[model samples]
Target: MLFVSRAIDKLNDTIATAVSWALLLAVLICAGNALIRYSLNMSSNAWLEIQWYLFAAVFMLASPHTLRRDEHVRIDVVTGRFSRRTQVWLDLLGFVFFLMPVCLVILYYGIPFGLESLRSGEMSSNSGGLIVWPAKLLVAVGFALMILQGVSEMIKRVAYLQGRLDASAFTKHAVTPEEEIAAIKNANHLT
Candidate 1:
C-alpha cells in the first residue's frame, strides 16, 4: 500500500511540475497577446484561447499535487484544535467521504462530456479559436488524478494510525512559522 502510495505521489509530483511551467507559459502568452493587440494591433483568437487552455490546465492539473502536499485549503480554525490522531481520522474521513465522492461525480460526468466533444470534433464558437475537446478532457483527467492522490493520502493516514509509518512521514501540514521560514531559507541556500 505504501509503495502504491509512493508511486502515486511520484506521478502527481511530475505532473505538478509540468503544470507549474504551464502556468508560467500561460502568463507569458497573456502578456504577449495583450502587448501585440495594443501596440501592433495584431492578435489571434487562437493566441487568446491558448492562454485560456493553459490556465485551465494549470488549475486542473496542479490540484492533485496541492492535495498530496496537504496544501489544499482547510477550515483549520476548528480542526487545528484537534489532537493529531483526531486530525488524521478527520482527514481520512474527508478523503473517503467528501473528496472521493466529489471526484467520482466529476469524473462520471466529465469523461462523457469530453468524449462527446471529441467525437464531434467540437471547435470553439469564436472564429480562429482552438478546439474544445482538449480542455474538456483535462477536466476529467484532473479529477481522476485527484482521486488517485486522495487514495494515497488515505493509505498514508491509515498507515500512520497503525504505527506502520512515522508521524513525520505521514503528516505534512503542521509546519510552524519558524520552520516555514527556515524551509524557505534552506530552499534558497541562504544562511
Candidate 2:
C-alpha cells in the first residue's frame, strides 16, 4: 500500500510539473496577444483559442495534483473536528459516493466525446480557431487522473485504518501545493 501510494504521488508530481508549463506558456501568450492587439491592432482567433486551450489544460492537469495534496476545498469545520480515523473514513466515503462516481461518469462520456470530435475534425465556430478535439481530450484525462488519485488515497486510508499504514505517511507532514509552486519558481529563478 505504501509503495502504491508513493508511486501514485510520484506520477502526480511528474504530471503536475509538466502541467505547470502550460500556465507559464498561457501567461506569456496572453501577454503577447494583449501587447500585439493594443500596439499593432492585430489579433487572431487561433491565438485566443490557444489561450483557452492552455487554460483548460492547466486546470485539468492540476486537479490530480490538488487532490494528491488534499488541497481541494472541503467542509473542514465538520471534518476537522472528527478523530483522524473518522476523518479518513469520511473522506473515503465521500470519494466513493461522490467524487469517484462523478469522475468515472465524466471519463466514460468524455472519451467518446473527444473521439467523435477527432473523427469529425471538429473546430471552433470562430474563424481561424484551433482544432477542438485536443481540448476535448482534457476532460477524460483530468477525470482519469482524479480517479487514479482517488484509488491511491483510498488505499492509503484503508491501510492506515487496518493498522498497516502509518498516520505520519499521509497528510500529517506533507509538502503543500503552495510550497511545491514556490520550489518550482525558485528552480526556474523566477524569484
Candidate 3:
C-alpha cells in the first residue's frame, strides 16, 4: 500500500512539475499576444484560444498534485475540532464514498464526450483554433488521475487507522498561523 501511495505521489509530482512550466509558457503567450495586438496591431484567434487551452490544461492536470499535497480546499472549521484519527476516518469515508463516485461518473461521461469530439474532428468555433478532442480528453484523464490519487490517499489513511503508519506519514494541513510558523521552524531544524 505504501509503495502504491508513493508511486502515485511521484507520478503526480512529475506531472505537476511539468504542467507548472506550461503555466509559465501560457503567461508568456498571453503577454506576447497582448503586446502584438496592442503594439503591432496583430493577433490570431488561435493564439487567444491557446491561452485558454493552456489555462485549462494547467488547472485540470495539476489536480492530482493539489490533492497529494493537501492543497485542495476543505471545510476545516468543523473538522479542525476532531481528533486526528477521526479526521483520518472522515477523509477515508469522503474519498471512498464521495470523491471516488464523482470521479467515476466524470470518467464515464468524459470518454464518450472525447470520442465524439475526436470522431467529428471538432475544432473551436474560433478561427484557426486547435482541435477540441484533446481538451475533452483531459477531462477523462484528469478524473482518472484524481481517482487514482484518491485511492492512494485512502490506502494511506487506512494504513494509519490500522496503526501501520504514523501521524507524520500523512500530509498535514496547517490550521493556523502558529502551526505554519512551527512547521517552518521544524523544517529549518531538520536541515
Candidate 4:
C-alpha cells in the first residue's frame, strides 16, 4: 500500500511539473500574440487559435494536478469548523457521494468525445487551420488522471476512517513563500 501510494505521489508530482511548464508556455504564447497585435497592427489568426487551444490544454491538463494538490476551491465554511475526525468522515462521504460520481461521468463522456474528434480529424474553426484533435484528447487524458488521483485519495481517506492511517499521511495544503510574498505585496496597508 505504501509503495502504491508513493508511486501515485510520484506520478502526481510529474504531472504537476508538466502542467506548470505548459502553463508557462501558454502565458508566453498569449503574451507574444498580444505584442504582435499591438505593435505590428497585424493579426495572425493562428495566434488567436493557438491561444484558445493552449488555454483549453492548460485547463484540462492542470485539473488532476490541482486535485492532487488540494488546490480546488471549496466553500469549506462548515468543514473548517469540524473536528479532524469529523472532517475525515465528511471527506469520505463527499468523495463517495459526489466527487467520484462526477469524475466517472466526465471520464465516460470525455473519452468518446475525444475519440470521435480524433476519428473525424477535427480541426480548428479559426482561419489558422490548426488541428484540434490533440487538444480534444487532453480532455480524456486529464479526466483519467483525475480519476486515478481520486482513487488514490479515496484509498487514503478510507484508511483514515478505519483508523489505519494518520492524518499526517495525507497531503496537507500550505502557502508557499512566493504566495506569501505576493499576498504581502498585494496588501493595501503594506505600503
Candidate 5:
C-alpha cells in the first residue's frame, strides 16, 4: 500500500512540476501577447489559445499534487476541533464518497468527450487557434491522475488508522500566521 501510495505521489509530483512550467510559459506568453498587441498592433489567435491551454493544464494537472501534499482548501474552524484520528476518518470518508466518485464520473464522461473531439478533428472557432482535442483530453487525464492520488490518500489514511503508518505525517497541518511570519523572517535573515 505504501509502495503504491509513493508511486502515485511521485507520478503526480512529476506532472505538477511540468504543469508549473506550463504556468510560467503561460505567463510569458501573456506578457509577450500584450506587448505585441499594444506595440506592434498585432496578435495571433494561436498564441492566445496556447495561453488558455496552458492555464487549463496548470489548473487540472496540478490538482492531484495539491491533494497529495494535503494542501487543498478546507474550512478548518470546525475540523480543527476534532481529534486527529477522527479527522483522518472523516478524510477517508470524503475520499471514498466524494473525491473518488467525482473524479471517476468526470473520467467516465471526459474520455468520450476527448475522443469525439479527436475523431472530429475539432478546431477552435478563432482563426489560427489551436486544435481543441488536447485541451479537451486534459480533463480526463487530470481526473484519472486525481483518482489515483485519492486512492493513495485513502490507503495512507487506512494505514494510519491501523497504526501501521504515522498519522501526523499523512494528515494536513494548518500553519499559523506567526509560523508564516517566522518562516518569512528566517528566509530573509531577519530573525
Candidate 6:
C-alpha cells in the first residue's frame, strides 16, 4: 500500500508539473497575442481559441494533484479547529458523501460525451478551428485520476484511524529546506 501510494504521488507530481508549465505557456501565448494585436495591428483567432483550450487542459490536469496536496479551497473555519481524529472523520464523510458521488457522475457522463464527440468527429466552432474531442476526453481522465488519488488517501486515513498505521507513516506534510531557512530567519529577527 505504501509503495502504491508513493507511486501515485510521483505520478501526480509529474502531471502537476506538466500542467503548471502548460499554464505558464498559455499565459505567455495570450500575452504575446495581445501584444501583437495592439502593437502590430495583427489579430489571431487561432491564438484566442488555443488559449481557452490550454486553460481547460491546465485545470483538468492539475486537479488530481491539487486534491492529493490538499491545496483545494475549503471553508476550514470549523475543520481547522477539530482534533486529528475528528478531522479524519470529517474528511471521510465529505469524501463519501460529496466527492465520490460527483466524480462518479462525471465519470459516467463524461465518457459517453467524449465518445460521442470522437465518433462524430466533433470540432470547435471557434474561427480558429480546433478538435473538441480531446478536450472533452480530459473530463473523464481528470475525474478518474481524482478517484484514484481519493482511494489512496482514504486507505491511508482509514489505516491511521484503525491504529494499523503510525501517524507519521500516513502524514504528507514535510518541511522543505527553504521553509526551514525561513523559520530560522524569522526566529533570529525576533531575537
lDDT at residue 68 of model 1 (Cα atoms): 85
Best by TM-score: 5
* Model 1 Cα lDDT, one tens digit per residue, 46-124: 9989999999999999999998888799988999899989999999999889999999999999999999999999999
Tell me the spans in candidate 2 whose CA falls farther than 4 Å from its real position: 172-191
Quantify all predictions' global Cα lDDT against the true fold.
Answer: 0.92, 0.89, 0.89, 0.77, 0.92, 0.82
Clashes of 2: 0
Q: What TM value does model 4 have?
A: 0.84
Deviation in angstroms for 174 in model 6?
Answer: 11
* lDDT comparison, 4 vs 5, better candidate: 5
* TM agreement with the true structure for every prediction: 0.90, 0.88, 0.90, 0.84, 0.94, 0.84
Higher-lDDT candidate among 5 and 6?
5
| lDDT by residue for model 3 (1-191), tens | 79999899899889889999989999999999999999999989989888887888898889998988777888888998999999999999899899999999999999899889999999998787888888898898889889989988988898999899886766764678998899899999999
**Tens-place lDDT digits, model 2, residues 48-153:** 9999999999899888888888788888788879999999999889989999999999999999999999999998999998899999999988888889898888
Between prediction 2 and prediction 5, which has the larger TM-score? 5
Roughly what TM-score does model 2 have, to 2 decimal places? 0.88
- For candidate 3, the 10 contiguous residues with the lowest summed lDDT are 166-175
| lDDT of candidate model 5 versus the reference | 0.92
Candidate 2 or 1, higher TM-score: 1
What is the C-alpha lDDT profile of model 6 across 78-159, one tens digit per residue?
A: 8879888888888878778888899999999999999999999998886767888988998998888888877777777788
